[model samples]
Target: MDPEGARIQDDPDVKVMMAGSTLRKVKSRSWKKQRHFRLLEDGLTIWYKSRWAGRGHSTFSVTEVEAVREGHQSEVLLSIAEEFPADLCFTLVFHGRQGNLDLVADSPEEAQAWIRGVRKLIHKAQTMDEKERLDQWVWDWFQKADKNKDGKMNFKEVKKLLKMMNVDMNEEHALHLFTMADKSESDSLEIEQFVYFYKMLTQRDEVWKVFQDYSGDGEKLMLEELENFLRIEQHEGEQSGQHAKELIDRYEPSETAVKQGAMSLDGFQMYLCSQEGSIFNPEHQNLYQDMSQPLSHYFISSSHNTYLLEDQLRGQSSLEAYIQALKRGCRCVEVDCWDGSDGEPVVYHGHTLTSKILFKDVVSTVKEYAFKTSDFPVILSLENHCGVEQQTVMAQHLSQILGDTLLTTLLDGQVPQQLPSPQELKGKILLKAKKIGGLEQCLDETLTDEVSDDEEMADGDPESPCTEDPPAANKKHKKSKLSRELSDLVVYCKSVHFHGFEHARSHAKCYEMSSFSESKAKKLAKEAGTDFVQYNTRQMSRIYPSGLRTDSSNYNPQDMWNVGCQIVALNFQTAGLEMDLNDGLFRQNGCCGFVLKPEFMRDATSQFSPEKPEGHQGYKPLRLSIQVISGQQLPKVNQKEGSIVDPLVRVEIYGVPQDQAKEETSHINNNGFNPVWNETLNFVIHAPGLALVRFLVEDYDKASRNDFIGQFTLPFTCIQAGYRHIHLLSKDGTIIPPSSLFVNISISELTSGS
Candidate 1:
């Protein structure tokens, strides 16, 4: 059944949206103006305009919308709350780093209509199957290509549409296909004809060759043939026959093919595109990892400068950044608190031009969103620069807003030998800050201690750590005064300065944690890698970007995780390869922000060193073979009208120093629509347990650096060994669906020395 047809009648809000209304698009307090808004008949897009007669209008797809916020939930809407009723406002939040759309309706009924309607459409988009998604994508292209709005396209328009879709086809061949689809004896074609033309153009010859190799007949695969394919190609062992029957039943679109227990070309393609055919193992998609282990046994997803949306020196500090981080399953968030002019502490980068947000509001936002994505504990790493009085106010806000979720005392009412598991601290927030006394002394009211803020400002010094003696002119020193009110909240995760590995191994408590700058952490991982791994067994460690990174760029978190560091913090506001790796590593195990470290890394006396991996126990190497087959619907890197991407695939492995390697396929010229490269890349990984495989696609260039098109990353343990589809993601980590690489992967164990 079509979901749209099934739900349209029961949805009155959707009906109201289709009827259209006049709304005030609010950018700022003074920039509110009337605009006409209407949902198109297709129900997949919305368009708004200040005047209906001109081309001065904008349109957005319902798929772009992530969620709808009612009332004055956004900063822009809050700025005009006094002028408008709360019920008359709403905001449309988009995926990735796109800005939110704030608007005001003439009536509360209109506001509710748009809000509920967009929410319903978003749900529909999310629930769409692969086949439905493809059809919708084709219709969207049709809409874009029909520039004259005549619902029909000439050959000229069709040619332009092909370029827009990242296709550089031969003109003579395109005209022939165009004539084949135009059965009306006319030079133009409609939407149905356009879809047919697309199907003919994108028929995968590579898939057809593979299909022919297995099928006795060229047209379909019989049950016995499919079982053979699964056994020989997919290495499914004894269950190959059962799995083949299931695939045919689920993916075969034709009723005759389903009854015959055979797979046609279409069904085979569908099976290859399904989750069962993806490179990532389906078993790892949910909460499959053990979560009952101590908190230090897993890698925690963390963000630094969580309140800033941009750079540290000058950026906007808003509650939205915290909300965004929490929504992405960030388990730890850092807040740098300074004294506000109004007595309440403010959160922002100190001595910078960045805007300030009240510390109370930041706590409130965290309280609301912390458990929305994952129920695991959230670590609030406070960089407290506030004085004693304002520190008390900050503590009050946390206790009041977070309330029961704020863990004010020990879990068992006694000091613990090891930190509690995520299961034991579900829905709880732990403070990671300096404390005045031990965990058992939190009940004392008058206890206070002074601690040097050296670790806090360690990276602020501009000199290199290798310098023997830096000049005194570059030195910056300070001490933070810990207040009892705030210290009481620090039950676990007490921030402390590192006094060297021998000292920590002898004296450090399990609940204590230390922060390290990226440069310092990198140095430790390189020089004392084994010691770092063993130290993280009992206590957690956080690795943060250096303060000299004023632009808020991030270092690779893989190196820190190589040493078993739990809290590897990065600037969540920045988007790059570092953030991509972070997103990919945490995308598994229910995306709960805690990935259990390898068993060797979790043992107390483990001798694992990323620099020298052969010394570790339970070390086994494996050979990885990947066949780069083809790409479908890859987006063009350049937006020029006639440009199409000359795409290539680069397979990269990130693990220990010995396992890091990359290999690329030759570039396919002027063909991003359906490029084929029947080439295989081989890799021998020394530390397979800790390795992450990244599949990157780039538009090859001779005169400059290769432009990144899309990529996907997954842990080596989670890779499915078979013919699979690797769906691609854009630079900002948004899914560019129907855009994927079809590949085959095989893994085998390596013998003694070879």
Candidate 2:
């Protein structure tokens, strides 16, 4: 016998039925037919083919095994059992070289000895046939114990077997049994545990279900479900190429092409065709390939200007107009609330509301509209024109209704010191202060004043005071101040939330020129946990000359450019001279142009080539028509003196269209000029769509040149566009030099439909 066969002899519970062919007759005719039946040492047997031929021979041995309790087949059960020693009482499979041997053990030493015996048998086995036979012995035992054909033996079966032997078993006890018997941790049991655990727990119905659930369909559960799902779907999508193309076409329109004057869909399509390497080009297979990754930059709102709700709703009934404006991309909404006579906060810009729009109605409308769309993320800034008492109540009510989604300004009761915790609302809250006391100091002062007034009531009888006693008039005044401060704070917080701290500004000065102190403002922002530094853009521009001077003067254009760049966000009064500069002749000159020429007869000449030359790079001087203006003086000599005359004196250039001729005519009208006769006049001819024109003044003496003054460069592109009125004002509202001279210009591209 093999060493494994030897170990089986040591296992006391292991029974090897070795009744010969004659003794097997009482069992069945088929059982009796087995002539050469060799009972292996591991409680399994093999019968020679002749004896097994007429009999119904199972591939596995017909013996009761302990470990095959949980619905596992005999073959599988024995295969699992052969891995460990027979002493440990657990129904788990053991992966071993000689298949799974049944563990038959009642003690750790006995199980160890059985395991040693099996190992010795495997080591000594010389021929492959002998080794296979030994393996078959183990497999046969597994087949006998496996009650209902499942492939695994679980803890329940092991516990039941312990219970049958009057030995209690818990999870720990079962794990102990498993660890001892399952030498390889492959969830298999050896002979002793297999036989004992199986007989205790095996039931026909339960075993059958276990077998069906685990290996009935003969398919194993895969480990890479998520990866497989994604890969399969992606493959399918790639296979349907047109579908993928359609998806890209529906979204991700080309922003660059759109910015470059591609207005209509057809225009965009044409541009794509013309610019073969552009994003919209379908032939470029790599187009949108990187779109799966995130974009490097995105556009965010810097700041927003809003009209007060009361102002807008003054003549209207509902908020439809305001809602429409919001749809047009207004980021901020302003609502001015005043305390009513009854102390209710009401929305109105003026002292009285002529319309029926109420505060509650507006709130309801805002909430309704907010629910309708997820795209519009609007922040509401409530300008509390109402008294302190009313504003606090209104703010609290609004907070309750809107929850944290709506960004609100700080209210009287919402001071950081007063809050139970730092204000952690859903939306941001900005603390607003016009002066240098800081938000905390302001709130403290307001609270102190309240306490001081209440001192009078200290001596009064506690019960005598009415439940709703009217507040003192002086107290009311103090409360009103607090309310206004709270309202301002709330507005500031709302601004910060929507446009970030950088865009928020103090409105305390009411559009005054001197409200902003950059350093002080920045300090205040730090205290408020914000980084916003607000300034009046127009005031800053006017007071601090942008340092761009054309004449021989101390100036710095680069510094001016730096200042402009620093002002990433600015508030502009759209109706002012700055607006005019953006829209008028200054635009025609160039977006960066600030100065106007002095001469009535303006000439524009480019010393450089009209088109950029290949590799020919250098600075180009822009030459203009120069004239000497004499204030109310006539030149002493004309062409008779033979001196150089004022080039612009007697020029009579005509045939230009009415729009093109207006800039020169306007200049002449402002200067009150008509040249003398008999003088070979030179006029800086400024015509539409022309590149450059020069004028040489003749007949007029050199001394007379001083009398005719001022020089200007008329932008030909502007003249062509029919904008005849020159902008006399600069961005800071300063008048350009020789304000009498006018030159029309327009250069920025206009939207196709607009």
**Candidate 2, which segments miss by more than 4 Å at Cα?**
1-314, 341-343, 367-379, 407-480, 483-754
Best by lDDT: 1
- Total clashing residue pairs per candidate? 0, 56
Q: Residue by residue across 311-418, what tens digits does model 1's lDDT show?
A: 877789889999999988999998888889989899877767899898998898899899999999999998877788999998899999999999988888888988
TM-scores of all models?
0.95, 0.25
lDDT of 1 at 657: 92
Candidate 2, lDDT over the whole model: 0.30
Model 2: how far residue 559 lies from native, Å: 18
Give the alpha carbon lDDT tens digit for every residue of 1-754 in model 2.
2455556555433322222221111111122222332334334433333453676443233222212222212222333344323234222222110122222334555334333433333343322232243245334445444556564455555444333322333568467656666655667665545643433322223223322333323222111221232123222223334432332233224544334322223222121122121111122222111111100010111111122222222332334433422332323344545566676666643333334345655565565544232232444544444455776676566666655555443434444321211123212322221121234454454532222232222211122111113446434334224433333334322111112223424222211112112232333333431121122211111111111211102221111211221111112122222222222322232121121221111111112111221111332222122222211111212223222223233212221221112112112212121221222212332222222211112222335332333222222332321112121223223222212221212222223343
lDDT comparing candidate 1 with the true structure? 0.88
